[model samples]
Every structure is written in structure tokens, then in C-alpha cells.
Target: MPSKYRNFRSSVPWIILFLEVVLIILFYFLFSDDDDASGSTNSYPAFQDVNHMVIFGFGFFLTFLKRYGFSSTGFNLLIIVLGVQCSVLIEDLLVLLLQREYKDGLQRITKAAVSMTAVVISTGAVLGKANPVQLILMAVVEIIAFHMSRSINTTFLQVSDNISMMHVHLFGAYFGLAVSSHFSEPSPRTEKNASTPKSDLLSMLGTLFLWVFWPSFNSVLLVEEKTKAIYNTYFALAVSAVTAFVLSLLTAKDGKFRMTDIHSAVLAGGVTVGYAAHIIEYPWIAMILGLLASGTAVLGSYCLQRCLHPALKIHDTSGIHFTFGLPGVLGALAQVVLLVLKDWTKSPRLDYLVMIPIGAFCLTISVALITGFLTGVIVNLKLFKTIPVSKYFEDQFYWEFPHLAVGF
Candidate 1:
């Protein structure tokens, strides 16, 4: 017990040190965004990619839980997700203040309220059992997806035309899940685990919330076009509903659908639609394409699970690059195709062809190089390491204690 106590004592300081480092990095990005040494309003807001906080944080949390051998409890996952979201909001506020931008307190509160509520709901669903391998894979995938998106933004299209951002979140979820399965331990409540009535109810509500707000989340900081956004939202909703219902039925046990797949599908379907939402206007065409996109991506994800992952030994759920980044780029290019086929007045063949090579180059090479390099640096430096591999399952390590970090 004395050794344990001494170990504990040393850990607290290390945890504090890690938190300080994370906070400092976050602030650096915030400060950089606000940087205008020449005092020009023209400085593009520093760190427009505040979404990285969640992607990285979520990846880190998974890594933390996995390295410590914790369970992937619903509640635990929820807490980590909430913490990441909170960090984003805090970062956002810092950015807003730094830029001297004014916004309504009510709007800010509303966002904060909903975000917090989501965290609470997710936390309530906890059941611990983490996989470190999976978590590491997740971090790797997210970094790749982010870099790919960044590359697309830089190389393809005018600032107003950038749509790659929507793909990162979508793909991240898929890739992360894949990686988790490969490296993480199985949840105790596997398919055989019965869903409590309460769990089912909560899952239903959570699905609805994500479905409704998905469009807002996707287009939040994009150039505003309310009419286009609304059309895209409904189109996405219809496709997601149809796909979720079908997948649920196909995977049901005793006539009751597997709620996990249902919830994940809704989110995935919404994200799949995000890629082409801005460019596609016709509802029917959007629905047809959305369904195709959802089905194909899901099928690809399933195949990745059984064949590619097992054979290659590459556990990755950083679906951001795969699901959204690549698919969305294709979706955008598809828009150009639709126009060519549907209209007789003019041809955009040259522009459309140009996008194909450009999108491919950006997603495959640029994202891989940039994101891979950064993630490798972080992992090699052990910037996001944690301890015990098993202790993390207990709330004490992840939430209650600060000292259980790696090397402590």
C-alpha cells in the first residue's frame, strides 16, 4: 500500500503537467487565429479548424481508456465525448473573444445547454471496457482525415466552394469503430446483451437529436445559404430514415432491431449525405444518391471489418478520410456529372475532370503525408499516453484522478 500511495503521489503531478500541455496547445491555436500583428481585419480567423479539438480529444480519450485497459462503457464514452465538446466550446469562446467578435449570450447558452445535455445522456449509458490498440488507430485515422480535408480546401475550389469539411466527422466515426474492433476488447453487452427498455428509449432520442441537428453541425461555419441548407437537411433525413429502417430489419433479433446499429446508421447516413448536400438540389436525385452513398459506404465498412482489417492487421476507424473525405469529394464531382447529363445548354467537362485528379491527389497523398507526420510525432513523443491499461475502466483514473497518466 505504501508503494501504491507513492505511485499515486507521483501520478498527480504528471497528469497536471499533461493537462497544462493540452491547454497550452489549445490556447496557442486560439491566439494564433487572433494574431494580426499588422492589425488587419483581413487576417483569416486563426484556428478555423476548432473541430480538431473534438477529433483529437476523442481520439486521445480512446487512447487513454484503451492504454489503461478500461471498458468501453457507454457512460465512459459519453464523458469523453462531452469533455471534448466542452473543450471545443471553451476554445470557441476564447477565439470569439480574441477576435473581439460579438454574439448573443442566449445563442451561446442554447448551444452550451444542448451540448451539455447530450454529454449527460451519453454518460448515463456507460459500461466500461476499452481497447488501446483501437484508440491508437482512431487517433491515426482522424489525423489522416483532417489533413486530407485541409489539403482539399487548399487545392480545390474557391473558399466559397469548400465542402471537404463535412467529410471529416463522418469518416472519423466509421474508421474509429473499425480500429476499435480490431484492437479493443469486446463489450460485455455484445449482441446477446439485451437492451433495457430505458436504453432503447434513450437510443431513440439520441438518434433523433443527431438526425435533426446534423445539417446545422455540418454547415455551421460554412458560407450561409439557408434555402440550400434546408433542402439538404430534409433530403438527408429521408435517406437516413429509409436506410436505418432497412439495416435494422436486416439485423434484428427476435423481431427487435439491434439498437446500436440503428443509432450508428442514422448518424452515418446523415454524414454520407453531407458530402453532396450543398451541390445537389433535387430531392429525388438527392435521395437516390444518398441511399446509394449510405449503402455503399456501409457495405465498404462491413467489408473492411471482415476482410481488409483482418488480413492487413491495420485497425483503423478514422473513417473521416474514407467515408466523408473521399466519398464527399466524389459526391461533389458527381454534381458536375449530373449537370452534364441533365442540361443541354452548356458543358463543364473540363472543370469536372480537373476536380477528379485534384480531389484524388489531395485526399490520398497530401492528407496522408501531413496527418501521418503530425500523428507520428505526437505518438512517438508520447504526448497522449495514459496508464494501467486496466485501471482506466474504473472512473478514478479517467475522471476522478489526474495523476494516472503515462509514465507516472
Candidate 2:
């Protein structure tokens, strides 16, 4: 707790050491003399792409806010790093609990990346309000709950759906929103959401990173279907990105586009298509799904930020409900129609829907809400203590910043 020992750089060694120890234990337990543990070597490229998406893609997406840029990126890194480490341990433990063997190497890393993505998404709801420590603790709880619910869904219930929409998108969005209830009381509805031209350009970098690598995320470990998966994701994103901007200009009060629309809603296609990305054979259908997803998300942002914020009495810094949450639910719903109409029950391939997935979805919803609420409660307790309001949304409280140039 000494000031000298508690600085950011000083924390690096312990974090690295902890991660190394966990990885060693996992590798030890999972190491195999036979090559059976390792799946196709092709997953490596996808794994690296997913890592980038989790670290840079999600981090910069939240940096659209003006003053809190550093905290957005920095805290995102912290929570994700911790979440990735915890993911390996927790996911493997669940596998062992189910009497299944743990997978080694890239498979484990892929799982970690997906789990970390979920944690990152959840952080969006409470961005700039909580310190990195609270986010880390929240990830610890959420990841476990996510894994448990995931296990019950996959192993026992055997629902059919892709990993991202069900496991990452839905779980993260709801969990973060639930925690946002306790993140803070609404703060006079500030114009802090406004972005400068430069910030808009910077935000596009996040958007593009996600746009390019999302195929890898949706297609990971799908060796046979990876190409088709990538194809659908690409088209879906293309349509979403274009539709979001068009809708933004059409719907904006000024008849101009909202930068926030470009920043977040453009990504709705990825969330929408996630449910059926690999399964949908037609590119046109993917585009339509993207359009549907972006339409609701882009249009709702105008209304939700205006009406829902005051009504719900909670401020969601990221407007994540519109970007990730609603689109994710839409993806799930659209996939159900595809399943029944396409007669997926007849196919040998089963993805996320059946009775079990419905249960898993409901379970994740319940667990995430309860866990997030308790996390808020625990962080608020004097033992952990929430960050003071004056200190919120500023980097000065934690980071050591040099004197800035005028107007910077």
C-alpha cells in the first residue's frame, strides 16, 4: 500500500509473475506426449487476430470519450489481462469438473480471448466510473459465472449457437448494464459524450480493427467452416457499417451524422451476424441481418440516450445497450428462425438454440445481473470503496502525467 510500491509500473512484475505461474500450471496439467491435445495448427492465426481484437479493438472503441481516453484504454488493458489469466484457470477447471480433458495451447488461448472479450464488453457499461481494481474483481466474478453458465448450457443442455453472441456479447452487455445501476448516480447528463473531430478519427481506428478481425473471432476453431464463417462476417460488417452511417445522417436532428453512430452502431453488424455467421450460406441474408441489427441500434441510440437514461436513472457511458445488447438479442432471435425454417434439427451440426441454450441464456442473464449487482455492492463497501466522483473520468487520479501542452 506504500505510494512508491503501488505505482503502475511497480504493479507490472507481480501481474506478470501471477500470469506466468498460472500459465505454467495450465500447460503442466494440459501438456501431452501424444499430439491429440493440439487441434488443427490453423487456429494460431485466428488466435492472434482475436487477441488483437480483445486488446486493441475493444480498448480503443471505448476511447471515443474526450477526457477519459487514457483510463478507457488503460483500464481496459488491466481488466482484460486479468480476465484472460482467470479464463484459462476457470474454464479448464470447469472442463475437469465435467470429466472432460483440458485442451492445451491455442485452444486454451482462444477460450481466454473469448472470455476476455466478454469482460471487456461488460466494462463498457461502467466505463470511466470504476477503477481498474473494481473492473478486475468484476471480471473475476463474471468470468466464473460466465463459464459455469456456459458449461451447463454446452455440456448438459447442448444448445446450438456460436460462441461470441451467446457467450461473449449477450453476457457482457447485460452484466455491465446491471453493474451500471450501481456505477454511479446520473451526473446531470453532461455533454461529455460529445467527441472532437480528432477523437472521431481515432475511434474509426477501433471500428476498423474490429471490422477486419471480427471474422477471425466468429470463425475461430471452425476448421472446416472457417472460410464460410469469414465470408459471412465480412459481408455482415460491410452492410452494418454502411447502414449505420446512412441511418445516422437520416435520423440526426441536424441532418448530419453522429460520430458516436460511426463509432459504435457501425459495429452492430458484427454483433447481429454473430449468431448465424458461419451457418448462413447466402451473403444477401447476412447483409439483411446486418441492416436489421444496425437499424435498431442506430435509431435507438437517439431515443435511448434521451429517454432511457432519465427513466432508468442509470447512465450507461457507452450506450452499450444500443450497440451490443439489443443487436445480440436480435441475433439470437434471428438464429432461432433460421434454425426452425432451415430445419437445423435434421443437420448433423448443432449450434446454440435448443431448450438448453434458452436455459443457458436465461441463466447467464440472471447470474450476470446478480453477480454484477453484488460486485457493485462489494466495491461500494468501505473495505473496497468506490472511487470518488470528483476523481471519476480523469486520468490524474491513477496515472502519472507530465505537464501537457496548452489545449491538449
Give the range where candidate 1 is weakest over 10 consecutive residues by summed lDDT.
117-126
Q: Report per-prediction Cα RMSD to one decimal.
A: 9.2, 3.8
Tens-digit lDDT track for model 1 on 1-408?
Answer: 346535654664565466557757765664333333452322122122222222232222222222222233333343344344343446365436445453333333223332232222211112232223223333324433543354445355432323444434433333333323323333444442234455455445645655555555544434556447557756766785677668667656666665544544555544555555665667777677667655555555566657875675444422333334334444545555664555535644666645653554345344434444344344333333423334324545444344756546
TM-score against native, each model: 0.58, 0.88
- What are the runs in model 2 whose C-alpha is more than 4 Å off? 1-40, 160-165, 189-194, 344-357, 404-408
Cα deviation at 205, candidate 2, in Å, is: 0.9
- Computed on alpha carbons, the lDDT of every model, listed in order, comes to 0.44, 0.75
Error of 2 at 1 (Å): 16
Evaluate candidate 1 by giving its C-alpha RMSD to the native, one decimal: 9.2
